[model samples]
Target: MRTDDSGALDLSDGDPILAVETLLLTRDGRPGGWRRAIHRADDFKYVFASNR
Candidate 1:
């Protein structure tokens, strides 16, 4: 998601996005503080969801 110029967290390198996705996909059972955090991309928000 594109952030406004003022007070924006720069994620142009995509590392933050990758890190968020990895954490969402690789966690074991039971939730933790990291899992409880809000993950977002541009204007889109993401959640840790499973088909099972």
Candidate 2:
């Protein structure tokens, strides 16, 4: 999860990683089916997870 000014996105703080643990998330322990993985903003549709 590393990027620079040449990043594909139009935004960057010279940082490589935006959010960590991009593979899993858990707001509670009931929705075992509400966790997912992807690189983007919070969709709240499937719960985008992160980790780095």
Candidate 3:
């Protein structure tokens, strides 16, 4: 989750600003890597999915 320049979580009438960092693992339970991601939302779907 993230906040605006004023440090406020204004989710209405504002830009979607959320930064997420996640770790990845290999199929054999090994450390694959990690990545930083950002998402933009302008709809009300009430669901979030990542197809990476």
Candidate 4:
């Protein structure tokens, strides 16, 4: 979760940001891993369905 530049949070008409990070060690015993992402909340729509 994140706040606006001015340090404010408002769901309505507010920009949403997403951030993720990953770290791992290779078989050779080397540490290396990093990931970052940011996007608006209403940028895209997602749908999920399931049947049982």
Candidate 5:
């Protein structure tokens, strides 16, 4: 993920920061590859589905 200039998380105030327990990279619904979780502070979380 991306971080702001202040060194804090770039996510919004109300956004939930997922720990990225697992990552599945694929072109379609099928799993193409897997990525291990990296415990980096600079890493930002991403939400695929939004309630809004």
Candidate 6:
């Protein structure tokens, strides 16, 4: 998944919605991976990977 801005939200899944939602709330959010960016603070990369 990808977003146009830092505050944008993106989602990806290879499983059921219920399972995805559970992972989103439990794993991704807790580890700051769900709504977080991967590049450096100054980098303008647009790619976002969230299993949740």
Per-candidate local distance difference test: 0.41, 0.42, 0.61, 0.54, 0.51, 0.35
Q: Residue 37 of model 2: what lDDT?
A: 28
> Weakest 10 consecutive residues, lDDT, candidate 3?
1-10
- Please give, for residues 1-52, the per-residue lDDT of candidate 5 as tens digits: 4555223544554454444455575677777666644333446655588789
Give residue 18's lDDT in candidate 1 (0 to 100).
26
Clashing pairs in 3: none
lDDT of 1 by residue, 1-52 (tens): 3454222545444434422322333367554434322233455655788899
Q: Name the regions of candidate 3 deviating beyond 4 angstroms.
A: 1-16, 39-52
Candidate 5 RMSD to the real structure: 9.3
TM per prediction: 0.18, 0.22, 0.39, 0.33, 0.27, 0.14
Displacement of residue 47 (Cα, Å) in model 1 is: 13
Give candidate 2 misplaced runs (Cα > 4 Å).
4-6, 14-38, 42-44, 47-52
The sequence of per-residue lDDT tens digits that candidate 4 reaches over residues 1-52 is 5445224434444455444456777899798666555455556566779996
User: The CA-based lDDT of model 2 is what?
Assistant: 0.42
Where model 4 places Cα greater than 4 Å from the true spot, the runs are 1-14, 28-30, 44-52
Estimate the Cα RMSD of every predicted model relative to the unseen true structure: 9.7, 10.5, 6.8, 6.1, 9.3, 13.1
Where model 1 places Cα greater than 4 Å from the true spot, the runs are 3-7, 17-52
Indicate the residue-level lDDT of 47 in model 3.
67
What is the descending lDDT order? 3, 4, 5, 2, 1, 6
Q: Output the number of the lDDT-best candidate.
A: 3
lDDT (10s digit) by residue, model 2, range 1-52: 4454226544455433334333343576443344322244432334567896
lDDT at 24 for candidate 6?
Answer: 43
